[model samples]
Target: MTSFQQLLTDLGNKSLSVLDRNIPKSAYVPLDLSVTNAALKEVDVSSASKLGEYINRHIAMNEGKVAYGGYLEKRGIYNRSDYFNQQNPETERNIHLGLDLWIAAETPIYAPLEGEVHSFQNNTNFGDYGPTIILKHIINTVEFYTLYGHLSLASIENLQIGDVFRKGEQIATLGDASINGDYAPHLHFQIIKDIQQYSGDYPGVASQKDVVFYQENCPDPNLLLRL
Candidate 1:
């Protein structure tokens, strides 16, 4: 693990809540939406409704309220969008750079740590993050950022840059397919050691050739969430 990752792990001994605190950690179940999940071949994952149905079933079967996974995972879900792949296999941004927490739309998302808003925007590209928020956090004299994507439009409507949010504070609500890049309702949570010149947006997916750099810049969010 990277030193930053170890720092996140050492931040706490228990899981952090990104969703409503009422939901226990046990309510979260791991999900695999990677290219190797053969079960996807039988389903039309391109359709938001269809893919959502599959995910909902998985959650129900697992007796979980929320489904979360997909850090550095090679996903096929990006195949439908040219924004992610432009007919170039090697350049396709099919590797997810964040951890996705799948849940119902309008579900409240909380701040896992105290932070101030760095930026927020509504990315309109197909398969993009849609309404997104980036929070800057400094702990132990180290500076970093946390990104919350696929958020409801209202989440950014009245948000201001540098707005302070305490740990466990409600930062935003999950957006539905119509506004959240046409995907199932989920929060694309990511951590960045270095955001470069990005603002209100960052690549939540990376090409295989760029995976190494992205993997380092955007460490596993699980290092903090622990779920």
Candidate 2:
């Protein structure tokens, strides 16, 4: 049986671009809610260790999930409430299993490794994940996949499944409110292994009961990005 450490080592060996050096050395910055003045008007999240909790609460109220993404149900801060498994299969629920990099629209997004385009779709709707993309990657011969959501409409215009993408290759641009499911532009990234018979849209967030499945299927992206 494969072990988690082995998985981590295998993933570490995969072709991935470190976000640290991708941006200009001076331009690279930590995620600070205060920098943009959200702290002044909203909650203060300057402390790094406390950031996660702040963000989790922010999403729970603002987006209905601990992680930021498409909340299919409708029960959150946006006056929207979407409990993950309320109406979905027994397998789906509102639990967050990934880290979200919130930034402005059109932020360049790149492939983390050499992989094939597994699927793409325009998950259009209010509070939806527009222009989503999933890539299948094989590392150490173990099969797994990564998901990219809330992308610009033009991102996948000329792309197709089975197309090959190299590490650092520009895959898409961040979407604005009009096309990105109506929230601040950001990247909704998740690592997925078993898709569990879902397509175009898999649960970006799961419920507490389903946390173990997501944790195993969607390993912390920090292992790859360290972002």
All models, RMSD in angstroms: 0.9, 8.2
At residue 64, give the lDDT of candidate 2. 34
Model 1 TM-score (2 dp): 0.98
Worst 10 residues of 2 by lDDT: 70-79
User: What tens digits encode model 2's per-residue C-alpha lDDT throughout 14-113?
Assistant: 5454232345323323343422334524442323224445654555455332232222221222224343335544444444565566655787888888
lDDT of 1 by residue, 1-227 (tens): 77788888887455577888788889999999999999999879899999999999999999999999999999999999999986787898999999999999999999999999999999999999999999999999999999999999999999999899999999999999999999999999999999999999999999989999999999989888888
Question: Which candidate number has the best lDDT?
Answer: 1
